[model samples]
Target: MARRGPKSHWWRTRLLAIAIVSVWAVVTLALPFFNSISNGTGPGGVGIYVFMAEGVLVLMLALVFWFARRQQAIDREFAMAEED
Candidate 1:
């Protein structure tokens, strides 16, 4: 009988991707509005801080996705080697 690989990691990666996109959407859409309402600042007022925060979030999300893709590639290579 052929062996089936584990699938939990696949689901976990999918969940992580979904969570990352959701958070990115929230940060991109909500932060500026909240900042403006709370700080009475427009996109040019203390809004620089909001932009900085969004930039950090984008960097983090990019790192996370990159790491996940690298990990998947490594896993695929290992699996192929094991099948030989």
Candidate 2:
């Protein structure tokens, strides 16, 4: 059986964290502009809901990534301990 290295998993988790943060940053910065654009046209209050949803989504994604990284670390530690 072939064994996988923990380094690759660590790098992958790091990349995912970076990507999630980048996306969240972009959305956070752009929300105001988007809200203004939406509010300028009409009385529709949908933009606020959309922004809220996006915020929730980004938070959920961050939470998931955090848990996944934690689980990966635990697994790696267990594997190492088993090998010892």
Candidate 3:
């Protein structure tokens, strides 16, 4: 039987970031375009400061979670390698 590889690979993190970014990009970028086309200089539906604060909070949360998971994975790997 083949042993399983570590879960926290770079590709996994990158794919996650790409997915989050793609969705965020599509929503943030396209909404304005459609709104402008449909309503002509629509209210942008946003307060810039609130949007900026929320975006930063979400990004920092993701970063912190990722960091914690990575550290756990590293510790697990170190413990396993030492056992061998």
Candidate 4:
């Protein structure tokens, strides 16, 4: 079996970071278009604006946590995780 090293780890980390950022950017940029289509109808009859205001915040927080979790897993795979 071929042994991977720091270079491999670095690329994996970079790719994951890019993917996370891309997801965030796409969702944020598409928000306005979705809002326009949905108009004032959202979950529980809430307006798109209201749902977006709260939903975006939640989405951001979720993404942050997701990134942290995934990053930690990558670090562990590379045997570089910090002591906790």
Instruction: Mark the regions of model 3 whose C-alpha exceeds 4 Å error after superposition.
Output: 1-8, 40-84
Give model 3's TM-score versus the native structure.
0.41
RMSD of each: 5.9, 5.5, 6.6, 3.2
Which 10-residue span in candidate 2 carries the lowest summed lDDT? 75-84
- Report the Cα lDDT for candidate 2: 0.63
Identify the candidate with maximal TM-score: 4
TM-score versus the correct structure, for each prediction: 0.46, 0.45, 0.41, 0.77
- For each candidate in the order shown, give its overall lDDT on alpha carbons: 0.61, 0.63, 0.55, 0.82
lDDT of 2 by residue, 1-84 (tens): 214687855665677678767766766667656776777455656757665667667766777787667656655654643333
Name the better of 2 and 3 by lDDT. 2
Candidate 4 structure quality by residue, lDDT tens digits, 1-84: 223799988999999999998988877888767666867576644666876778888988999999999999888888888889
Predicted model with the maximum lDDT: 4
**Candidate 3, residues 1-84: lDDT per residue as tens digits?**
213454544445566567666756765676546555645333544554345447656865776687656645554554433232
Give the Å error, residue 65, model 4. 0.4
Model 1 collision count? 0
Model 1: per-residue Cα lDDT over 10-53, one tens digit each: 65557767776776666666766666565745547555675656
Q: Which has the higher TM-score value, candidate number 1 or candidate number 3?
A: 1
